[model samples]
Target: MDNKIRLFTGGTQPTSVGPFAVNEAEQVETRPGNRPSPRELHVTGTAEVSYPADRASVRLSVGNNKTTVNEVTSSVSRRLEYILQAVRQHGVREEDITVRKFLHRDQEVYHMNAEVTVTFSDFDQMEHACSVLLEKLDRSVSVGQPRFFHSAECLNRVRQSACVSAVENAQQKASRISQLLGQSLGAPTLVREDETREWRSHGEDDEEEDGGGGRRGQEAASTQVTPLPRIPSVTASSRVSVYFRMRDGNRKKY
Candidate 1:
């Protein structure tokens, strides 16, 4: 029924005798059998690299309402033609632009909608595309922000970089520990790791692109189109567990 003894670091063990606590016993008994043993060191290391995305995906949606389904579809087509022309003028490959979905429905009234998507391999060309599409089309079209992704080659590089950093970090820690305890550190007996991932975003506008573009109010005056900035950085990290064998019967210093 005594909480004091239960809460002690040594708990209710028989050797709860002041300084001769569980910690001391653990150290004293560690080498009792005199068998070679190793100490574990756990630490984290991170590596990051930036590379331009290889591909970009953008979504464009056009909608129209008319008295009949036939009238709605024609209006949608007209709007799409302008957008398609704008995309071509901005250097987008014809094969890269494709319609993802098209629909015409009548629920008492007529409604039509079409979803168009474009893929780009060049970052500079992709940025100015949206504005070009907007300008060429007489009717308004909703454009979604672009999505960017690194190629497989970039991902492989990041993984290799992070693994190297983690090993170096572990070795550095082992050497420091050995020096503090007046002991020599042996080669690493084991190496393991934990993993993490990170993503970053960046944006570039037209006025900022050519160094002479303007805000929305200046759209009419601006001839050079501005493209959204490309996000080019991704990070992957790993933590290592390193074990170093002890030289003699003495426990390695903390």
Candidate 2:
């Protein structure tokens, strides 16, 4: 028995040689087909805009506990009606108001609660309604502070303005950098928004309303003066990454 070992070498095949790689004579050829990527300047720009809140929402609730369910219900319902009337008298539409009632029993005593929520476009009117409701209602009624926020349209506009400003800022930066490098700034090749951020300047707390305004200890001479209301400001920001083509200052394009 004869055992012979055969070795096969693998390399570039002659028939598969590309036309751009080798000529007919197979002497090896090259073409200047692959072009280098165009020079570009990448810059990131950010912009933020603060917009005043345009809408306000106020929540008022009445809760009481009594031996009988009917007694508790009567107490809550009386104040609930007054709150609704006060809100409506200040030009609030019916659709902008919401009402809810809940009843439960704890041991021998029954508890009843009623909540009213009203949305207002005018802050002054909202304040007036709240003042009137507080004056007429008993200490059992709890009135929450007004929650201010921007409407959908207002928020959308603010974000759009911020994005546009960011792009403009990027263009300005690219132009300045190009000038400093002794190159001419060319048209933008790519633009993309990398991130967006939004925040409020003030508190965004939930319904933390209490029947009593405050503890007697917290009151001081400074607290005696009525402080002006502080409306929250909504801020929207945008960050954009931009790529602009780099052109030779001395060269002219045909």
Candidate 3:
């Protein structure tokens, strides 16, 4: 049996005995077959683009409460009309607005409650509608802002930019790595790609309240709106992946 000791950590010595004695030259030679050729390299590249959004969408909710479900629903329907009228008056096109959701549910404090949601296209128009409903209706109504958005063309363009960036990045990285290894980048022998989309929302979420910080009338007249208005901004992002091959010579394709 044999024994040997080597430094394992600060002020620490580890011992090896019997079959534990290590062979440095044998280990290096054994792994030579597994070592990668100097000319090969792998890298990831990325690209991004930002553009102003050209459109917006928003939904507004209006509701009423009463002793009975039917009565509450009828009351909400009546006042909601007025609310819609006010929104329309602000220049929101009829086609742009849609009834997204509506419901009549029982409330413990009030007995019956009704709610209606309207979606609009323009941000400015949505804001204006909310302002009028809060003022002209002279009652506290739930007001929500339009959601900003971008066009499909803009999204596609971003994707293409990302792809280009990824490929270029891979090429540059491969070139540097090959240079360090005493070789040159080569044409891509194997290639692959992937992508992703991300969306971020910007807005304040305000609570929906009845008439005046409290529930009141059963059948408030439906709110009415005017014409339509301007759009809002929406942003989208994409990511790309690429693979490149490296050779031992400078004759490489981009």
Candidate 4:
């Protein structure tokens, strides 16, 4: 006994059908409405834009270790107060200053630390503040390196411009590729951003100290002989990716 079954499409006389198992004949029916897949092209585009820094930040620290907590706290507070006064005199606004305090107990000694962060929109004012602090403050007070950065508005504007440029770049690339293949680029069927990357450059200078006695004399003499260091400029950058579709010459717009 033969055990073969034949599949047919709309009574087409079996049309050289493939052999099927007896139990699988119901699942082998052919339909006449299947459609072919559409053709597509894939490409990626990227762009980068840079913006200058419009703001600066500096962190200053004061600390003291004494036998009693009150003693340590008072010392740190006094130094911090003087530092804040000097900062404000240099044109830094009170709202732009942030303060933090920490206390720790060690064997037979109490330690108190205070940190003040000042942000400035003007580079000249920031430099003057740092110089004043290093020149008049006590040795116990330490000034950190100034950090430059872009404002929020600047960053947003640059990112938007970069993304737009990237899309334009993608369209130009697709048009050129389609032209080489004798086809014309059509409207974008899909647009996707692969990822966005941000780049920032931070500049740091060596810390300056208010030398005491002989050290101060040496620094004063050196300042007369050495040129001032140049302040570094902060740079912010953005990148993006884009995709577009391709069309035939009959539908080409140009």
lDDT of candidate model 4 versus the reference: 0.65
Residue 113 C-alpha lDDT in model 3: 29
For candidate 2, the lDDT comes to 0.73
On TM-score, the leading prediction is 2
CA lDDT, candidate 3, residue 128: 69
**1-254 in candidate 2: lDDT tens per residue?**
11111111222322312221221211224459944235656677888888998988888999999999889989888878888888899999999999999999999999998988889999889888888877887576788877787899999989888889888988888777878878777665556676788887774534334455655535534377544557888898887766666667886522
All candidates: TM-score: 0.46, 0.57, 0.39, 0.48
Q: Which stretches of candidate 3 lie over 4 Å from their true place?
A: 1-40, 46-78, 85-114, 120-122, 144-165, 175-187, 193-242, 245-254
Worst 10 residues of 4 by lDDT: 18-27
Q: Per-residue error at 137 for model 2, in Å?
A: 4.7
In model 2, the Cα lDDT at residue 251 comes to: 60
| TM-score between candidate 4 and the true structure | 0.48
lDDT of 1 by residue, 121-225 (tens): 776777687766767653568888888877687777776777677668667766766567566665544444444455644545423353455464466456655
Provide the lowest-lDDT 10-residue window in model 2. 1-10
Q: Residue 129: error of model 3 in Å?
A: 2.6
Off by over 4 Å in 4: 1-49, 159-254
